[model samples]
Target chain A: MDSSLGGILSPRAIRDDGASMRLTRTIGLAATLMLIAVGLVFLRAEQTRLAKATLALESEWVHLRGERWALQAQVARLRTPAQTRGRMAIFGVALDPPRPASPRTPLSRLALVP
Target chain B: MNTRVDVTQRRNGTVVLVGIALLLVALAGRIVHINWTLHEKLTGIADRQQSGSTIIPHRRGLIFDARGRMVAGSRLVPDVFVDPLLVGDVDALAQDLGARLNLDPGKLADGIRARAGRRFHVVARGVDEVTAKAVREMRNPAVGLTMRSARTYPLGASMAHVLGFVGRDGVGLEGIESWHNEHLSGRDGRRRTIRDAARRALHGVEGGAVRPVDGGHIVLTIDAEIQAAAERAVENAVAQFEAESGVAVVMSPKTGEVLAMVSWPTYDPNRFGESTPQQRRNRVVTDPTEPGSTFKPFLASGALADGVLSTTELIDCGMGRRYFGRRLVKDVSPHGLMDIKGIITKSSNIGMGIIAERMGDAALYDIMRRFGFGERLGIECPGEASGIVYPLRRWTSMSAASIAMGYEVAVTPIQLAAAFSAIVNDGVYVAPRLVKRLLTSDGTVLEQRNSRPPPRRVIPSDVARYMATELLVSVVANGSGWRAALDDYQVMGKTGTAKLPFADRKGYEPGAYLSLFMGAAPARDPQVVAVVMIRRPNPSIGYYGGQVSGPAVREILRETLAYLGVPPDGTVAMTAAYRSRPGL
Candidate 1:
């Protein structure tokens, strides 16, 4: 009975068991915190890249819209009849009347109706 | 032994410390150098991204008439290019493109093969809208299209001279385009993008764009309808008289604004290269010819203004000719004794010489100068001539006689028109201008051009009125300009048939004459002044200004008055029926 009590209260045994428990808990907490920090850093870098791309696209879009407006205005101004006639006159060209059809007799016109 | 061991340990420790210090210093220097180099490279990249890669082409401005109708403008077109290196099956590709684009398959294959290593080659230029659409839909990876603006003359040949033509790169070559090139050419912008090493667009760099500025619009003072009428008149006269060339100008007497200026043999701006340089000349402003009898009115005006001659004063024009110092000044018909009004009406050289002698050369020259002769009309055209008006000191006795009869003096059609305007416009000489106003892109007037201030009174109001009234009688009575008389309007005009000077100085060409007619309508209060010149008309047509060119002027004036809704003068019938009646 005395030997049994001595084994149960052994100092080496108690020391070894306490040391294993402390080491395991420290390793587990350290690994979890490291993973959380890495994930947050990756997410932040991706958001920054997307914001930069979006800004560049918006600027390009604005520039294109301005060019479109200028082209539209030019087209609208070019397609008009009065302006066309004025330009032709500068070249000293005059418009001519359409050619008249040949005269047909009344009897010939009636025969064609049949 | 113990001391030796301790000393060796201390020496080793010192060596280790020195090596670590040297390594740290080398590392710091390399790091600083790399950081500075990176900063410089980044700055260079930013600058290149902002300025390089894409180019912006300048666009030509639009030209519009007074009614805001477009005459000349720019239209967007596509330019096609091919990447020769990327093209596969050259023959097959060439055949397909040739059939669709109307190109020779062999030529396409040769061109593509010659530029084998090149990334791009121009396959076609100025493609039509339909062809451009087809090209875009082709979806061929090797082909690319870039949009560019091209100059278009919508009115074709009508507005050619006024609107002018542009080169392939859209630079104005003549007319108003050449005159106002700087204002019409807009600034180009650029779009810079970040590109990979292969020159493929990666992404648009931050702040890498410059917007293009559009050219300002030009509004002409000419009314399109009036211009068309004037053009028709000139064209008809040119064709009818078989004249080598002709010109007509209509101007507002009050403001000297050119409403219609026409020149025959003018080329279509749309096809300028197809015509000859002689046809391209703006004869109204560029070519100067002898004033012929049209100059008689000015001589008459000067004499009347100086009180040297009265309308009723009789002058002797014995027979049909008179000898003045070995020079013969001939009259169209023999006049025993004629009044001042009769001398102008008959266009008598002998009678005019007698009047010119009383006025003296200095007085006549001064009057001509004051009327804007021997000077440019200050028009907007580029190549305007200053008509020849020699100084009185350069004149001989014969020079005075010849100048009085519309000889030895040269004047442009425009100058003649302007001078006639002064005669009818209360004697105020104003410079002629084609540009009425210059506007910004958004219809804001940048500058409003006003008529030039009158330099000096060449004639008094009464004398101007008297001369104008007499000219009106000449148009209706037995004057040469009988055909120019309007049916229901009081036509005031003068007829001039002056001999053209030969290059050989053989006095003057006998049959070769420049027929001219200058007049204003509604005699009492003139609104418009027209001058017409027909050069080298068929002698068989009896090349008289009153006969050949007068009818054209009448038609133009009638149409112009009707178009402007001017009411007809009821007094025309009485004026037309009234005979010379000696003094009446």
Candidate 2:
């Protein structure tokens, strides 16, 4: 009677069930590894995007510096004595440089608040 | 029949399963071999495909005058270049680019075709910002722009010989620019980055990257206003006299600071290529000439200092001519007997020859050396000439008399000015200073104080004061330098008219002369010493130093004194100061 009952729960059936469980575990680990790899790829792309933005800012900064220097140079050129003289000659007006304030200068003259 | 079919099917299924297992094992082995064996090679290939590098350009320093006005500066301008290998439809592209850049299309096309194998060809350098923007907006892969600093002299030719011009390679070629090139050319930097597939820099790499340090800024002691005035004065003199060239220099007696230095026939630094080499020479420090009567004060100073001649001593003028060992010493006019003061006042060559004889050659040479003649004076300029002064051992019999009358010796205008400053500065031989301070890009200030030798006492203070205040004053007051007199100030100076020597040093050139005047003003305590030198003026207009350069010196001193806020001699306080001084 006991042998007949053992025959009902066969060793082949246990082997089949164990094979199915092993397959399920293998598929689960592989999906987890795939998720981690895809996450890393997205992180790398985001990092590259940030770096590109930084590079753009750096390029803009350099350009602004160059522009600032060019403007300063232009201002300097205009301030040259030769340029001033040419302008003075062209305008036919004599422009005397304002005298620097000295100890002798009156306070009212310096204030210019008439 | 059924039993036999089942047995065959089971054997075939077993064979198929074994075959499938062998294939899977072989695929796994191949994967292992690739990952382990070819790892380093493949990784190297990937790194090379995803790496980029670029140079971070460095900025050159600026040059400013004493008033903080920009004399020489630099700006980042774009250099246009083309990649011939990458250009498409070369003729069409060249036409399009040439139309925008004002270049000839035929030449541009030829240049591109000729350089087809090369990666880069320079189309233009230092393009203006607007042109650079136009090129950038072209959006063509073949065209590119690189930033480079272009040096600009804002004051143009007015400050050319002093500030100088920079070369195409961004190196200084002359004057102060050349002397301070290393300090002006800052270090360049480099950057390494990781790139994407499109060759865009994705990230800066960790190692082998450097940041650039900017160059130090140079602040010159030149006052821009005074420099302009001096330049205008010199230009006027040159034009009025129809001279070959001219030079004017103004310096502070107390600080040895060069306030203004102008060399005429000057080339504009912005357009230096259009000028000749002669126009580019800085004659103030580079060319030496005989100073003629301008040298008499030093001779007189040496005589008085050595007790060789008294202030009241009388010497025979021999009626304007005397012979010293076959060399004839002649005066401008006949004078019978004159005191030491009369000799200087009359500018009698025979009288100076007698004084030279009394004060031997060695003593005279020593005094000239003490007065900073025949030496470089170490001013901040390139190609400075250490003027010619023969040693006592090489002195001919007539050399003493020749030197005494300002011959057989050479002195640059700067050297003469520095020597005269010794008299003006109360006997101190202070070195000429062109640079006042050097400010680094980091905001650190480096004062140029005590960089060279310290000031030395060249003569007794009393002697220098007496010479500067009394004798020189008398020269402008009652002597050859009379043209240099100013109505509002007591002008003190001497005039010189030296004949130009032949190129081979054989003899003087007829009808060619260097008219020179060196002077200081307000007389009691000298503030500024100015030297005006005019070369090869029209003899018809007048080549005398007192007539030509004296008036120029008078103009310069007048403007310089007024600019410096020095009170006029007519002021009661100024007159009292002159009266209270012991030496005067």
Candidate 3:
């Protein structure tokens, strides 16, 4: 028993409550879908960034390994007998003179079981 | 008028509806066509444009000695490039690079200016680590550095012939490198990735990824110390005799493990371009020459094993000369009468010729084959030459006499050494092996599960012992191999002074001789066999093997035995000979 102004066209008819409810539900569903799509895109981008970072780290480690091998090659070249003879002073500083096999007699030390 | 208006309106509405309906049908047809036909093609085109892949490079393997020292290695240097347009402060960058790389800054600037429109211009290759680090630290957007590998021979010319050089594109070109290339250079992997608008890899799967496997490692049986001694000895012999070329081998008689193998005219693999083609050849395993009297011991072994000659039976050498058919063969020295043992000890050609003719061609050739002649020994070396022995059909009247005295047949140095190793190993022949083991990148040892050869009997143990004691021992004691005797060790050996063919492969090359000495140590129970061959030594300094290659063998055996810790079995006599007569 609500009051009305017009004879046939009243405020209750103008409201159209069912249609409004339907429009609100459709908008809410569409907005939720849009949020989910944006979240998936961001997740993809983050994954790419992390993958690139990991590859960069691995490449650095590979580089370090390569450098270590190169340095070792150089050291081997420097330690050859001919090189040692040429640069005796340099190796003499790092290496001690020959240690005596034992404090006892030389023949005893030379005597092996073979 | 009202009725006419109604009919016109109806016609107009019908026409408009029909047109609208047709347009709607066309739009639906177009949508279906796009979904069914064009979708796959457009998607394929997009994928081709957006995704890419590249090979992940793997480093080549290294060669190591038995003691785990690096003989051949690879260094990962940088291949530096630059984007000429994007490079800023060109003068400053050029100066910095020039200082680091030892180049002229002015020339570098001019080179960069020439590559005006190029995105990538290679500035330097094989840039060392320190320079590469300095360039990277500059952080210039234009400067790009990619890793490249260059081979390195740490010991230079030490084992250059064995550990060969690599080619321009990082493939093995020679020596052990080429033989074990598949094992040395592992399979390269690939990285398939998608890129964004800025062309950065998203690291996603387009197809799939394969993990790269690094090359397997190789360990040789050669000891670095013993190899050095052998190399020095050969160098000294070549210098002393002024020989054209020389080869030397130190092998363990028991296992046929080659301790040291050396060839003169060796080239450093690092600077492979500086040497001539002649210097690059590994004559030890590749070159076969006519083995003169060194072939006599095999003949004696054959004669005894076939029961054609008794150990005590005497053959008259008759002043060192013997005639067969029309050819007169002469020995190095004169011997009147000798047993089979005496013939070997004296290296008498006539005695050997008579015994060999009695044995005939088939018996001699069968014995030769049993001793591993004219066939490749499969020593894991590249370019091994299978020696030449004429077949039965090719034999002439002089063939038996020639073959009997160690001529008409050519043999490689390694073949002769291994043959004598059988005599030293108590009549059992084991083919020589150079590669000790193979290891994976992760330290897993790979066994040669297939390539091992079984030991074979050549002569009986009694005949071999007699040969080692009577024939070989006497050679060192008083024969042509007298100079090869060591003071502390019991030396047993033979000598060969062979005439070489002319360069045209015709008759003998006058004044050219191949002086060779083949011997084993601790003659009573031989442990090691050393063979030295000096090609075309100067006649002025004496071209006899006992003189030319003997001293070198002496020094080499002394060093190798000491390194192996072989105790002196003849010390009492050795002390009298060498210990300065300490009590005198």
Candidate 4:
């Protein structure tokens, strides 16, 4: 009685049962692999972003340093003794002579009763 | 049988599960190590990438005169910079900046294009405060203003020789500034900053910092008021005489400190580049000339000190000419028979020749060396020449006679002045000095330069006193230096009119002579010794040292005496004694 019942079973039902089990095993493996690949891609994108940021900062540093050098040179030129004297002359400044008595006797003592 | 089989399977499953758990734990340990290592590397890279802020320069130190008046110093000026990348309307910006800053449009354009993408380039430098304010008000985003110190000289053209000028690079080119460059320049400071990708300064980052050390200040011994007076006197004399060049030096006889040293045809330190080499020279120290009759005093002192001649001893000048071998030494005029005092008073060439023969060349050369002739005064100023005074061994028969009359010997004005000062200061020869002292920023005397030795006695004090008395008589009675005589003071001095030797000319060009007057006032005890020399005065008025360079000494003395407040020696009789001498 067992052999006659088995022989009467449909081919579609047998194929469906084998196919569903194989699909389940394949789907489980694919899902696990997909999760690992997604994690790696996210990490790679973050690293690339950080590298660009660092490069940008270096460029800015270079620019700032250049500015500082130029400014410093200009300041040095203007503060030189020759140029300063020229500017003062344009402004009409004069030097006062030394008061021979300043260092010797005080001016008060040198003054006469007249 | 079923129970035994089920128990065996369960044991195997448990062993497999334990193996998987251990592998997973090992993988987690590796990942954790990698993350820690990566974090460290990333942090280091980020730190290296951080930007720093621009450095700002500090002001330089100030240079003041002896009176604490600002002479060479720095003043704040505006500097303009542009970020070419941010600049708009390039032509308009160029025109505006060029107009305001006095920059050429073409130069401005080239500057902007030179560093097109650069964050900052100097658009204009050293703009006045008012102009800088105007630029700031323009409110251009591309333009930036920086306040910087520019060196300024308040006294223009007056003390140019001593003060010196700075180059475009802010370094001293000549004079005192050049000599003390390191002490007069400041150390620059720096600042650091962190910036983002857009070059915006980031806060909370370690700001790098360095403070600037300002340059040391200098205080000169020159008196500006006297300097002006001296300059004016020299200029007026130079113009009036139509002289090629001239020099005047006012010095303190006791200290050997130079108060005012003026050389005519001088250029302003501010416009040094535009001046000729002749104008740039400090003739007082650099140029050597035949001192003419001025050399007679030193010779006379040597003769007196060596006991070769007495002040009262007489020498004969036969009709202005004396034969030395085949050479004829001619006096400017026939001085007739004269004593040592009379010889100097008349500046008689034949009279000096007689004294030279008695003293001999060796004794005279030794005395000249002791008086700092033929040597650099060792002053701080550069380019001082060692004047030419030949040794007695090199002297020919003619050389002795010529040197006696102030020829065959060349001396700088400084050396001449120093020697005269020594003679009048009781035979004590003091080395001349320009710098008085060096001071710190807080007015502390860092160093005092008064370590010079007491003057060496070159002549007897009594001899020097007698010579001073005689010199006073010369000025008051008949010497060419009479113009240098003071109103209420006894002035003693000599006059020199040496014919300039030309490479290609005949009969000395009639009027080409170095007119010189070397003198001291308050003859009883001299305080100031002044030397004035005028070169190549036009022959229109019988050019002589007495006629050309004399009045300058008078002007200087009058002003200097009033300024010094030295009471006049009312004893004018000393001058009368020389006037009563026989055969004047």
Best by TM-score: 2
| Highest-scoring model, lDDT | 2
What pairs collide in candidate 2? none
Q: Candidate 2: where are CA atoms >4 Å away?
A: A1-31, A83-114, B1-52, B88-92, B104-118, B193-203, B206-209, B571-584
DockQ of candidate 1 (2 decimals): 0.04
Off by over 4 Å in 3: A1-45, A78-114, B1-55, B81-124, B130-143, B192-209, B448-451, B571-584
Off by over 4 Å in 4: A1-114, B1-56, B84-96, B116-120, B138-141, B193-207, B451-454, B503-510, B577-584
**Residue lDDT tens for model 2, B1-584:** 88899989988988898898888888888888778998888887777666656556677888888988888887777888887866879999999999879999999999999998875689998888789889988878678887777788878788899988889887899988899998888876766778654455677776646876677889899998889989988999999999999999899988889999999988999888898999999999999999998899899988988989877777889877789988988888898878776777677889989899889989999999998899888898998999999888899999989998899999999999989988878888888889988888764896555426788998888888888876787778778898988877788898888999998879999999999999998786688999999999999999989899999999888888877877565524444564565533
For model 1, give the TM-score of chain B: 0.85
Selected candidate, larger DockQ, 2 vs 3: 2
Q: Tens digit of lDDT per residue, candidate 3, span B13-130?
A: 9989988988888888888888888989988767765664534556688888767888888776688887686677789889987887788999988889999776567789887678
TM-score of each: 0.77, 0.85, 0.79, 0.74
Model 3 lDDT, full chain set: 0.81
In the range A1-114, model 1's lDDT, one tens digit per residue, is 565344433566546668676466557657877888888888866654664475466446544743664455555445544554667778877643232222233576667866
**Candidate 1 per-residue C-alpha lDDT over B54-131 given as tens digits, one digit per residue, 9 for 90 to 100:** 545545667777666667776656777777866878998888777768899899899999999876688888787688
Docking class of 3: acceptable
Off by over 4 Å in 1: A1-114, B1-59, B82-123, B194-203, B453-456, B503-510, B571-584
DockQ of 4: 0.02
Against the unseen true structure, what C-alpha lDDT does each candidate score? 0.76, 0.84, 0.81, 0.75
